[model samples]
Target: MSDSGRRMRTVLHADMDAFFVSVELRRRPELAGQPVVVGGTGNRGVVAAASYEARRFGVHSALPSTVARRRCPHAVFLPGDHTLYSEVSRQVREIFERYTPLVEPLSLDEAFLDVTGARRLFGDGRAIAAQIRAAIADELDLGCSVGVAPNKFLAKLASVEAKPRAHRDRIDPGEGVTVIQPGSEQEFLDPLPVQRLWGVGPATLDKLQRLGVVTVADLRRLDLSVLSTSLGANQARHLAALAVGADDRDVEPDREAKSIGHEETYAQDKHSPAEIRRELIRLIDAVTQRMRKQGVGARTWTLKVRFAGFVTITRSVTTQNTVDESQEIIDLLTPVLAGIDPSPGVRLLGVSGSNLGTPVAQLTFDDVADERPDWHAATDALDEIRDKFGSDAIGRGSSIVGGRIRTIKRGGQQWGPDQPPSREISHEDDATR
Candidate 1:
């Protein structure tokens, strides 16, 4: 209990070490100590994960595959198997459930578990983290770093601190588990770099640096009025709270996803209207298929267009009835796409669904029956066929061209920046799948 008499919380953040590459290595034990990189090998490919051996040579996730190859010529590269990764991720979640019901998954490879209620059944936070690490090692042969803290923000940072680092000469095996007792949060955060704090990106770092703030301790001592002049008032206050360890967030479990989206950056800029249409249709098909699989429908559909110069624009359409059919979404977004000029060349295109809810069937009058087909039933049948065989076994004719339509894997990482393709304009790619 604290001075305020509130019950202390025990939050545990468990993050898989080199998740994508580690899953790949499980079957190929021969690659154990070798440098391995997993992602697309194409010129436009981005690294999804890299083994510590590969990191020593400066290979890391989100780095362009071309640059990764130049940096680590001897590294073995593998196209990530997202399906396999998802299956393993589920198994990992099951292990977390054995300890606590209040588990919040941050991604396929990491989660936050509120174990304050489970201390009696599973010892303390440190003991629980150790057991989880051992179980994963014993059952999945994978490495996991765990951080136990009093709050979510510090727990996530502690997990990062617990991860092994790759040095030029060798890999330093981390402590595997780090715990911060209550009342010690500020002590733990003081020495860390300010950039380690959430939302402190390159621009924010430069601003803070001009104020002579290099560490969390420095930021903590700086006047709020002074910091606000450099960073905005809201951002300055938020950082100051984190610097002094004043986070009050709880470990929320089973948070519902807000939206689903997908986007692709072309190796070469796409200028042709026909090519852009083909890509748009494919994206619509993918997003709706995901919606049907998840048993949700969207009331709004969003289209994203990024031209060659990186000038981005978005168009959105809303409907009274939820839509989960690919053709319907394509019909709605096609006109929206037509309004945008692609003359300068389109570098990226994206489609997404928002305002999602359980798809409800609307009654049709006999007179209008001829105008509308039972698209729900038709799509359900198609889904069964695809499930029995594979996603590519059957597809809409318009979405498929001469051969197969190119599709990127739905994974934890996206190709370019780690952020959503269009944060200000569209939704994030629903990577939970």
Candidate 2:
């Protein structure tokens, strides 16, 4: 295609392979070639990311660690280090932003960049991607894969195709930066499974499978009207377009996060109310810390639980005010937990804050003297201390007394004063243990 006809529109999807586990390996290279699963390392813990070695045994993220161990007994289980991962992710983003302002981060390890306009500023799309991938590897010592295509869908697919493999001794130089030009995206995507499509989750895949639509080609063969009738107009249209490798979505530079949340799946099902409360407290602390760091406050709290059979439910409540207090979260969550029928046992629990607002500043007054300490100054000091000495450097005395609570790092690792503990919930009307 002519340059003007093609418009030289190049979209890139950059993703770090097994991001959490990769960060750990970068810090301790000895862990290389071993199966590493990063997540909660507790009785009630879940896997966040399974290294390629572990995946060979069918281990994957969000799977209960107990099950993961059964599947890959030799896997090295590491508690996630959120702080370290966050720092590394920041470094990666810095590299992307340096190349182009049109960088959109999907998560800590994945993002998209529109490099069309950047060619004039930097070089061609492939050259910019090479620089970005190189920067991440050199500066952060972390390997990342990049995909380049004419649009977002193809770019994302190209990245997935570029996902790193364990056998590569040296990172491939620019091999990750695969380019799918216009008119070739459809052929490139046809053989892939429908599940590879961005919006095709387990439920949707199951539904599509019922109609014998197992691959992208099959889905593309169906009439658009039939797809619209089955999957609704908007989703059907989007899926149809995606199947043909026609994606009009731009590389969004300013993607806003709709919500922020943290969750944990226990190695063992928790049934104790008190234990559940303790877990909630820990989650509150972690979520609030993230909110503070992001300079955002939330007005709603959502509690998510998954039962033994994988039945999941969510309950949310809007607060009169936005407060990050752990006790407030406890008060709000206790009733919700009480209402659930605790039959099979609780396998997972999560807390999410939404309806975000500008972070509010705290106020404090000195009653004895007609002077008050600057709230901002006090907050800054506390933040500094915590940053330098770690989260445990300062915390509520109540939290200290609650020895069972643990800190969960962004990489899905759990650390605390003691081994992480699981909680139980009882549905019995009268029970004395």
Candidate 3:
């Protein structure tokens, strides 16, 4: 074992490099060394990921694509392929399990691994991180930055510093790997800016700046009273601990999803009542299919609308029956949908199902129409055919009547929803999916 392995670091943080764009580049290697971006491709589409090459031109995620074009006209923008990205993330995660079972995923592209318990079997924390990164590159053709430290905060900070082209100030590690010695956490963190602490945001920073707090070292000097004055007493205590590189939080192995729903952003605002209603039905169909496939039902349904100026409104309804069918959910939501004022044009519309629970046999208020055997059988048949064939094999006439909504995937295998070409998005693209 290497010397670094003799004294294993306790915590590690690993982040995949430009995950969305990197997955797209795997199939199109010709774009290597060029500025590449992935997101919605419409005029008002947003940038989701930009390559290191594109960052030189000030391109970044969530920046409007039109502005991104204005900033880097030469950059290649591809509509995000979320389905492929999710598969790749699964492969990468399996590799982490091979090294240590104490891995906690931060997102699809990042995770925190506690390797203190695996040193005898895996060498050390640094050795384990290297193995994970190399396996991802060799098996999945990806790059990542890994940081090893005494705790989660410093390890997370180290991973950021390890990113390519990160500006050096102090505590520079000069490679994709940064390992802070166990006893040197304070010395390595002191010279860093106050923002390096987790709780110090712009408002808190302004509050701290009003006093003399600037760097971690400066914060380390402030008494509890001053930090309480700058922030609340509770926040002050939390930041005080972080300032000295003391974090006792364990590396939890699981991060559970609290809710699930689908939403889309449009290239242009949609205003027509009929057009919007059609879109709503498609959204309902998509959300319900996913819900039923997962064997879950929701008591509440919400419709979200956003105007051109970004003024947004959300309306929700509680139904007597726990619902997962498109017709049942839309029946309860119809009145709420009619009340929306689409006058100024709507930029986005979404349907969300919350208050989820295990599937229950509902009698539908003893209504005879609700128990129609023919309709239930037909729905089952369509779902089955779509799974065996492709999603395009079968779809509701309502979804295609106006021909506006496209790309509907019936089975849960896919993450993208049915929408206009420019505004279409897949669930795999988002963490909630």
Candidate 4:
């Protein structure tokens, strides 16, 4: 192991098991041990969560619901209610915050907690983990798996191993939460597959495999320069550090989102420029609506396009000031799209905003003579309706050009939902087949 790999700090990875399906099962105990899949409920829907029972039949998240149905004929499938799921996630986070303020949420279901200082106030790592698990179970009625180790890498792996055994009544599972001491993080991670490391996706792993670097240990043995030549300097250095379990990034309290983006893959590749423009407008409207709901405006606009051949390219522009104007954003991206080679059929389209700032408020003055009195009155009325009913209560005609919009509400938080289904499927076959 490298010299840096030997140094370590206490880190904990805590994750809720089968979070979405588990949350659903909690309310309906009769569904226990049954197969459940949660996501969109339509012919074109995709799976968001699959119960362990459903997974046994090859059902998994992101898989088409049509295929999932073929695997688990009896599985209960439900359209994911983001609002309900978010409420449960909020309660779960509140439980974690009680234990440690230094919580870094990876997603709605998982988080990393820096309990290094909590040892003195609470107890040892294992004891603190037990307390956290108990608090979640007792207060939120949720099940969670926790791994306590000397650093983030090992802690994450330990959590994965401990997930299936978290229901154990005793202090130890069969292998116990594989605890790697201060100097053992690298040794524990070395034998794992190269693909297991963060950022080592399929493309990168394919490149590493061709070079005969199959394991983390093998990656560590390679010259940094050789790796850099293939993977670029930044990625190579990051991977080298990860190979030996030497991540120095600390658990942050408030990990602000650097960007907010959304993308959709069409059922078939689109070749028409007019069709693409229409889709772009829809995406821009959707994105801007979300920005408004979040009380944020962004200065950076990014466009991502994936061709039929799977080659992807991204173009971006940083503006002088934060903007949430849909038309302005679409205008800025028009030329960027025009510059791209349009011969390749586009399969996916995405829009993202970054360099966010506080939300902009429209100013109104009674003394203004040129302003449209009726337009200003209508705007104020719409804002009032949004504040009371919801953001989706009122929208401009241009906003809903080709699609219906839904409002997503989770606890006190509200935002625009993902695109709605063209048609709904029956809820009778909602459970796993």
Please report, as a residue range, the 10-residue window in candidate 3 with the lowest summed lDDT.
Answer: 424-433
Off by over 4 Å in 1: 1-7, 361-372, 401-409, 416-433
Q: Per-residue error at 224 for model 3, in Å?
A: 2.3
Give the alpha carbon lDDT tens digit for every residue of 1-433 in model 4.
3435424356889888778888988888899878898875554567888777777778777887789889889999876777788778889888888778889989889889888778788887788888888888888777788888867777898888776532223222323244667767677788889998999999999899888999999999999999999899999999998887776677887877788777766655778675666666667766876777677878899999988897999999987778776656777898887787756788778888999998454544743655634433454465568779876766644334235333323311111112444653221211111
TM-score for each of the candidates:
0.90, 0.77, 0.86, 0.75
Misplaced by over 4 Å in model 3 are 1-9, 166-174, 319-322, 369-378, 401-405, 408-433
* Residue 6, model 3: Cα distance from true site in angstroms: 19
Q: Let me know the TM-score candidate 4 reaches against the reference structure.
A: 0.75
Best by TM-score: 1
lDDT for each candidate structure: 0.84, 0.75, 0.76, 0.73
lDDT tens per residue, model 3, 46-128: 78788888877888888877899999899998877666777888888899888778889887788998888887898866787
| RMSD (Å) of each candidate, 1 decimal | 6.0, 6.3, 6.2, 7.7
Error of 1 at 216 (Å): 0.9
Best by lDDT: 1
Of 1 and 2, the candidate ranking higher by TM-score: 1
Ranking by TM-score, best first? 1, 3, 2, 4
List candidate 2 segments past 4 Å from native.
1-7, 42-44, 165-174, 202-214, 266-272, 307-311, 324-347, 359-390, 401-433
Candidate 4, residue 117: Cα displacement in angstroms equals: 1.2
Stretches off by above 4 angstroms in model 4 are 1-8, 165-178, 210-212, 221-236, 263-286, 303-318, 325-350, 359-380, 398-433
Q: Judging by lDDT, tell me the better candidate of 3 and 4.
A: 3
